[model samples]
Target chain A: MQNLNKPNFKFTPLQIVQISVTVFVILLGLNLWTFYAEPLSKVLSPYWNDNLIDILVLIPAVGAAVAGTLLTRQFEKGETPYHIWQAFTIGLWFWVAGEIGGMVNDALYWDTIYPDFSLVDMFWLLGYFFLGLSLYYQLRLVYGAKSRSRRRIYLGLVAIALLVSAGLTHLAIKAGLGEGYAWIILFVTVLYPVFDLTEGATAIWISFLFGRGQWSRPWWGLILFALADSVNTFYWLGGYGFIPVAAQTVLNFISVIAYPASYMVAGLALLSNYFILRYGENSGLLKVAIKSEINKP
Target chain B: MKYFFRQIEDIPLDHSPVSAEVYFRGENATGLIEKQFNADRVAALLFISGTPGMAYLIEASQSKSISLAEFSSFADGVSHTRAINLPDVAGRLMLLALESKVNDKFTITTEEAWDKKISRWKQEQRSGLVEVKSKNLHGFIFFWQGELQKLDLIFSTPQGFVSGFPKLNALDDSAWDVTTYVHSASAQAYQCTVLRQGAMYWCHKILVRYQEMVGQKLLKMMDRELNRQMQPWHWNINLNENDMLDTHFFPYLMDEAHAYRALFMAMGAQMNFVIGNNLTQRLLSETFEQIRPDERAALQSQRLIPAAFSE
Candidate 1:
């Protein structure tokens, strides 16, 4: 009887155009960042590529990811605009940090290590990281959730530890403390991504299996971030040669289909489960018993 | 003519049609139009109440009358046994009709599919009359039109609300007739009734109170029928008030009278209209009161009791 099909509001022509342009700019910026900035930093100083970029970008990215998790918690409470803003902020900060790391790596680290590195190259690298960071964070913050103080504290601590570790790793390398200790600091920086990815995945799996399905909002955001990171990594390094590229292209095609295909599968599962849930119950106790059985191992 | 039923299913998808039709007339114009224009093309497909995914079209043409036993079997075949709760069969049928029309060509736009479905079923079915029947978990007699037999009236005693329908083949029956033929299989009988009186009363009240925007004529017809049947009778009083009454009532003076059989006829009529099937010929055939009680009893004797329960 009620018209559930109608959306709350229709987008105007100008709004549609704006969104299209924003999306296009974001995409172009990302390609430039990946193709130019990332490679240039590595070319300038191979040693700094592995460690410095992780410090500047990786830690902040982890913080942004944690912020996404916090925002999801807010969303469950029915906070809409606040949730969206928080998610955006988390994504923004993480991306900004990552870009700064890239810029500092190219401008300061490369210039110091290699006398041939020019300021023009440094500026280009800075612009590249800035553009890429903006694009990634913009995408991440789409779902917007409320910010949590505890998460903020945790992210700050992580940032402080990363900066201190980066400085210590640089000092130790200059003193010839050897690659073993530098690798230890490198491992610390890597922990940011590793921990965020693991937490996000765990939250998603747990919510899906144990918690109400509605509670999986944060998990979805994290999953998206993890997926994007993985894809970007593969794309940036040009990891695939001609043979791998062909294989991956096919895989990507399947993956694209796979995304929408999952929805159809989910719909069927829901319909079957609906009948079972709606009719099978006799007494209230029987309903409880049935639910328990469904939840069983 | 399309007859609308309420609260057909517990869960409805974001986009799904919800209506059914019963054609008593020999023609299947509605069925033809639906097949020609599928409804799902414009809208995303949603599940039918009991069926797996919405299959859409169900034709209850006069060419093939679905008996109570067959109705139960067809319903069971579609619904998974795990979920035993039955949705309103009439409502489910309408939902099926809506789904059947879904296709790329038929539903080019939302209004094209939805408004068109509503218009065709309602407009076409109103011109004719059809007789249909439905059932419940426990045995009781209810109908969209007609009278209840005495024995059935007593057996299906309602704690609060009650309704009845005459058998499709037995419009001539009198409830007061004292004979074994009333209850016997050879007499006019029915397996179940369609609209439960209690539920219908509630539905009527809600519609009248909430959906005042619907047609006034329909509201008046529903109200007049409700008031007529709801009268408390300490003495025998002919409840018929309209000059051209399609339904008749007979009080059972003896225990042998069969109200259940009469109730089935009325339910069948309701089902007929609900599915957008024509029923004018059946309603106009020999006046409602002209059918003798003996003729009604004779019709009951011909009905076959299934080897097992209808469920």
Candidate 2:
């Protein structure tokens, strides 16, 4: 076949896809194995599930750092691409720090969970700030030509974030969610949904902007993260009897698979971004990433 | 037509008004014109001496709005016949200097040859004029205190700024000129490079931001990297001092826009490596954007920022 004559580099994309899929399967399988498989479910329940979450989340976080290092070399340091990758790198590691902290904290208190305002939240929150910076630069690069539209996009995303976060918070409070917790804990507890929804909106927008390309998967990966966090928030809001029977079953399903799935997707997203930029750039996608050819309005 | 230049009778040693003195004057120099180039061979090869030099062919035909061009730029669409009659007191007050004292001892053809010669000259601490008398290639280059100064090597002599340096491939000349020994002292050859007025603010901003971002030690390392990349391209822009950019002189480059782009590209790269790229790009965009619209327009007009700063 003529395909056989192609250079070895061509297969890298295939290899990436295969390896990522394998990782996703293993992680997701480990998280879900307790439910479907007979005796293995009992064995893996708390210990293996915790381990899976750590591995899944850390993979993407570390991947972001490594990707940042590699991709930084490819671009001129003071360029848009360089800034975007660096921000992402720093931001992702912040999440990793939080994850590591949470893991350690959990290990120390095997029997009990930390309070609502754990130190881990601090790292995760800071991660959002840097991650926001990366997105700022990333959007700056594309929207330079006729940035009025870009301004509108910003306004629109912000409005959506505000509306959704307000609605969710109100609903969360009304459902007797914070009745027992301290008011301070309640304030922090509701912040996750706000952040997650904002990021979800942005990721969905970015996904649409990029279309169904190799790069879109990473945004989708973040979407999973947002989805998982939202699910966690929903469950906290006295979700019992709050939903239809079928919908409640779906939420339960989401609860089981969502976090692990989010970590796997998000981590792989970072690694994939690196691969796509470095080795999978033959598709002319990076040009789109750094410079937008969208017609001026 | 034939033109012969008669050397001026020696002026008193104290009389050093380079603009007024006619060093070498010729007559009927048009007939000696070589066909390979455009522009009429002017009646005189006016041999004037100073730091970085400028040459003008003030045709007798166009005495009205007389213009002076840099020595390296050739005037096009004119005939040798027009240059037969030279105009005096026209384009004369303007100052363009050449290295008066030629040290033609080290004649070089290729750039590779020139590199070795320059190194030898540096080792020997040689100082004199390096004359380029190859057919139509007439540059009065000089060395000062073991260094062939940037003025003699750049295109900034005519205008205040130079775009880029000339590469060996860009030479387009067959034989290199001789290095004639004239001045042994370094006093005369110390012509400071002139930079564009508005380019000052931006260059200062860039260098300062870079310094602040990368720190002094790494900044020196970046300077070394810049020179390393620029050397192979036949440039001698020494960025040892950051002050040079803010003052009247920025280490100038001479020649095409593409060559200038390479210098900027290299500089940008060094900045990125030393500092995070966001700061680098942000500094560039922010500085460029913050300047007055007129200043920005002036810089863009001069193409002072290379396409490497395209983003």
lDDT of 1 by residue, A1-297 (tens): 111122233653234334434543443344334434666356765544434434433332443434334333322333332343344334444444545545555556644663333443344334323323322332222211133554454455446545665675566577665555447544443433443444335434433432322222333444444454444434443555544667777645443333222222222222222222222221011122221111111
lDDT of 2 by residue, B101-152 (tens): 3323545678888788779889997754454434333344445557764434
lDDT of 1 at A157: 47
The parts of candidate 1 lying over 4 Å away from their true place are: A1-92, A113-184, A203-218, A227-297, B1-311
Q: Tens-digit lDDT track for model 1 on B274-294? A: 111122122222122233443
| Cα displacement (Å) at residue A202, model 1 | 1.8
Badly placed stretches (over 4 Å) of model 2 are A1-17, A35-41, A44-61, A145-177, A212-217, A239-245, A254-258, A261-269, A276-297, B1-311
**Could you tell me every candidate's TM-score relative to the true structure?**
0.23, 0.43
Instruction: Return the interface RMSD of the candidates, in order shown, one decimal each.
Output: 23.3, 14.7
The number of the candidate with the highest lDDT is 2
TM-score winner among the candidates? 2
